[model samples]
Target chain A: MEIRSMRFKANASAKLADAGLQRNLRKAKGKFVDTRAVAIKEIDDFEGTRRAARDLRDRVLKDLDLWLERFETQATARGATVLWARDGAEICRHVVDIARRHGVKKATKSKSMLSEEAGLNQALAAAGVEPVETDLGEYILQINDNEPPSHIIAPVMHKNVEQVADLFAKTHHKPRKTDIPQLTREAREVLRSHFLTADMGISGGNFLVAETGSVALVTNEGNGRMVTTLPKVHVVITGIEKVIPTLEDLSLLMRLLPRSATGQSISNYFSVLTGVKQPDESDGPEHLYFVLVDNGRADVVGSEYHEMLRCIRCGACMNHCPVYQSIGGHAYGWVYPGPMGSILTPLYAGIENAVDLPNAATLCGQCSAVCPVLIPLPELMRKLREEQVERKLRPLAERLALKAWAWVANRPALYALGTWFAVRYLKWLAGGGDRIRVLAAAPEWTAGRDFPAPQGKTFRELYRQRQP
Target chain B: MRVALFVTCLVDLMRPRIGFAAIELLEAAGCEVVVPEKQTCCGQPAYNSGDRASAAMLAKKTIAEFEPFDYLVAPSGSCADQIRTEYPGLLADDPEWHGRAVALASRVHELTDFLVSVAKIEKIPGAFEGSVTYHDSCAGLRSLGIKDQPRALLARMPGVELKEMTGADECCGFGGTFAVKFGDISTAIAAKKCDNVVATGADAVVAGDLGCLLNIEGKLRRMGDEKTKVLHIAEILAGDA
Candidate 1:
């Protein structure tokens, strides 16, 4: 979550891309962008749906407290224990306390990023219990011990099948197997045993349906179902922002989530778990606990970034983000990457700690345009930059440059003169070539690029001539 | 229609031909074009660099200069997109400035986009005998949705072959201050863009924003592939296509 050397690594990655074709990013550049293109073409009114979903979320955030209360009340009355946690430590302690009280030896988990954020596995392990991941991606990432997850949807996106096979080899104590099918089959076999023997089940809530106190999980894998049904105790860990006022409010999000995430018309499984199983039910967790972790949502409640809480965790913003496509999430140096990560990481962690988030975007507005719930990501980034400046976090040179430009810009004559002189100086520097062959300290342009001086005149000069 | 040109700082300082190209092309399509000397940079650099007060100062200056025009047009898609999409949000703090920012933002347009979408220009008077690839600037393509306007004009050029480049919509690494602050990364992206242009084997690379063109063109020079020249879309549309 705290990446000290992210900017350094990002700079290094950039250097590599300049030195070569950037083979690592290129391998998926064609693949990810192209696949998304095909997938986008398949959805009719995808843009329309995007706008509607954005509007829906805007409406939701306008009165977040009302929705959250409605959800908690409904869920608590539905035979489920609803717990509120203001921070990760609290959430971890709560979950651990439950396991300790129930004497839980092993727990099967269905890929919860919230769990990852809460550091559930480590706490559970310290309490002498094992929390085994069941979702294919999370399970893969967990066994590898590389880190938590780079992507919200694709935890192991950085890992290819080869690395996965290697991870399995070390874990299973066998020779390396490179085949994709073999790797998956081995994981499936290994997880199947855990599911059967697990005393408790843990899963992240996709949507906390307020009307029925029911939690809806949309997963491609059936692991979630097995985790919940096979265990005596089921725990649904989610953010406070995941609460929806009604099932109807949640239905709109259901349509937007899958299409935005993996481009599916509908996920394979849409499971709705309401509290615990009934008395007459043959199978299902007898005890159910819903843990709502604030993490940092409360701080942003009335702040300018409250809309960020409206995120449904679909990973749409990340998938289409240009920056994420390049460094492939690792460079974000945070659990989340891309547009959402850029905005959220700094807020979740401290801005001073994650100084790079504000600078991550190109300010292209693509993230906002594609955002299902219209979060003004670029604008938010600009605000973060302002926060940095207000805090005096940026270098004095950059701040002074802005101040000087501001003073000159407010005056027409000075701005025009400054423009004229700069252009003339450039022309003189280029000396009839139109190309500045050599550039100074501002070598960012000249380092790997060049600046073309206009042919004898600047646009302002030409316009002045036309005016005269 | 009477139109006022907001020639961006890069276009003004680095490439004046893009301005001429825009003027000639717009005039050829039958619109009265005026270049206002009172205009300055769109304040994107300061704005993006977290100087809101300065950005607001520049935004106020821009509003004062261009608010009376029928429409404010710019050759760069990135600048036009900024005026339309970002200016209002940036100035929302001051209610009076907010209205002015919104007013100025609403009427601003990218040159080719204005020429097509508003003025309804069918063809520009131009022809060039060469194959060229077009790089879709991120702000223009994604921000303003000026996808077909530039391409539509290029596709209809008389003698030019409008070949497509791979990853044409990717950033050219000229992200204002991003170029300087994050140089190593910006150059890498620029190198990728240069390769796409070279891969097309086109004589020139064309784009809506001069900023992107300059970045790509510079990389082409550093990479020692001078055969691939960089041209603004307006220049190509203004020429003998």
Candidate 2:
């Protein structure tokens, strides 16, 4: 995916102007936030579970090499082939080569953010193999000229039922059905045939168990199962950071993952695939392949940002963010949006160009509070901002202004004298009005609202006068 | 307890009444309150904007100024938050200031928190209002855990009828410098916040921090809502009972 993170402010303004998008996003924001809160309350020892999950993830990241080697050995022993690709291009090359080897003309895919990161569909298409999306949300986006998923868990969260109905009517050449069940039925009918016909199946693994050599696929719909099972060749594309040391760890995280994302006590389908179908087994893929992608995970692992690798891609942080709630996903202009996007976009896309991603947040801490893995999101953002300052990426005028303010703030007499004069100057700027119409150093502050005029004596002066 | 009032720079300049009200509330709660003449801004504007050096300088100055007191209380939650929660982190690497910063941070409290928790005040001797709604400033609510304290204080007022507003805990978009930097987005958020406050049809909107009150009040006035009064929680608590 292209790094459009630099255009965040402009994109946010454009998104803010779209009332329809605002309405839909606001509704989703409330629903997701409320449901997540309720879902969390229903679980016993939820915080304890979250702590255990965080510890396990941290343990896995600390020994990523050992885990990966163990996973490769175990998975290979279980008759599944594992390949490690350092970057997206390499991952794409391997996928294309595998598709051609299998004589795959068409492949059915479940929702895989890793594949999106790898641009596998475009790679496959260039290699003369078609990709069919089996997940209903992914299918809707795929049919609509391959629009990127607005959300991680819920691909078409930005789209209302009416919009989906219109798109389905246009794409399927049928009458529009605004009802959700009808829409699902129509999508299922269209996708079922593709699943049967496609030669290869591509899906993302939620968790890679190092001990068992098993990949956990968590989904609310049956399509994830179909995409992995129906095709002749099944390939799992996922980030290298998705590995866990044991199935015991996976069980604890799965407890929080579904609850945190979509607010379900448990997802409908939780499939654990150990390897390919045995010779005696009737209905499963003959070949199982794992593409463990490391676009920048290796670098982030030992760095100060190793904690970010703990993310389960739950989308809980985004679901709970106030800034993300105000501005929809497209405003972020990336594959990821909200709090996780603010952190990941800069790391993955290049921090120099993606500086605005860190600053977009108001440091509300809701994302941090809701995170199942307990990523200190605000602290990470603050550290990123500090890096930007050190790199001199901040504007010179703003930087100079901050330095000047600090200089004044460092000295009590200077701060007192400066503010005393500033108050009087601001009052004069008000021109005998209740609110200041114009001011130096800040025109935007007075754009929509007036700056409240300061009153008579500064508190220090008042306190001195009132001394008995 | 001898409390040193860190009347935040905003309350000191734009609305000294809030400072005086804070003093009155503290005095009524049986604490000896003193205003430290050397104290100025809390350096949150610098800290939040990623200028740790400036924030560190101000933190040192603040720590020195309030070092003599048994307790340091601020009228603004944000200022208190900066002093109490952030100062330790800001000066963590400083060999000279780290211990002092941590010491100051431990004794610091927001006005309502001090009144309710430390002072252990069962009732305040002042109040007057119609149906009043309270805005939970982000720092006070999230940082200081000060949601119920002000409301608990207000509950003591006989004339004041507390009406809850939607999104009371939502940020009013006065993120210190954020309002000036991203004015359009700030104004949009403030406008939405003001709309929620207005929806309650309350006679006045009150909050623990002056920054939020000013932002929400400014938006309300801009939207021709001059009649809906905006007051700091201190003012309401200090009003005649």
Best by TM-score: 2
What is candidate 1's lDDT per residue for A1-468, written digit by digit as tens?
344434744544653554232444556454534445566566677777767777766666677778778877887787788898987788889989888878899999997877766677888888889989989988877787736676788776666666677788999887789977887888888889999999999999988877788899999989999998999999999987777766787777877777667777678998988877788888888889999888887788778787787788878777666666656666676667788888787788778867767786677666776666778887788888989899988888889988998788777689778877877787788887858876784776676676776666667767767774
* Candidate 1 error regions (>4 Å): A1-24, A30-44, A416-421, A424-438, A453-456, A462-468, B93-96, B121-123
Pick the lDDT winner: 2
DockQ of each: 0.66, 0.67
Off by over 4 Å in 2: A437-440
RMSD to native, candidate 2: 1.8
Return the clash pairs for model 2, or none. Answer: none
Compared with the true structure, what per-residue lDDT tens digits does model 2 show for residues A230-277? Answer: 898999999999999888788888889998998888899999988889
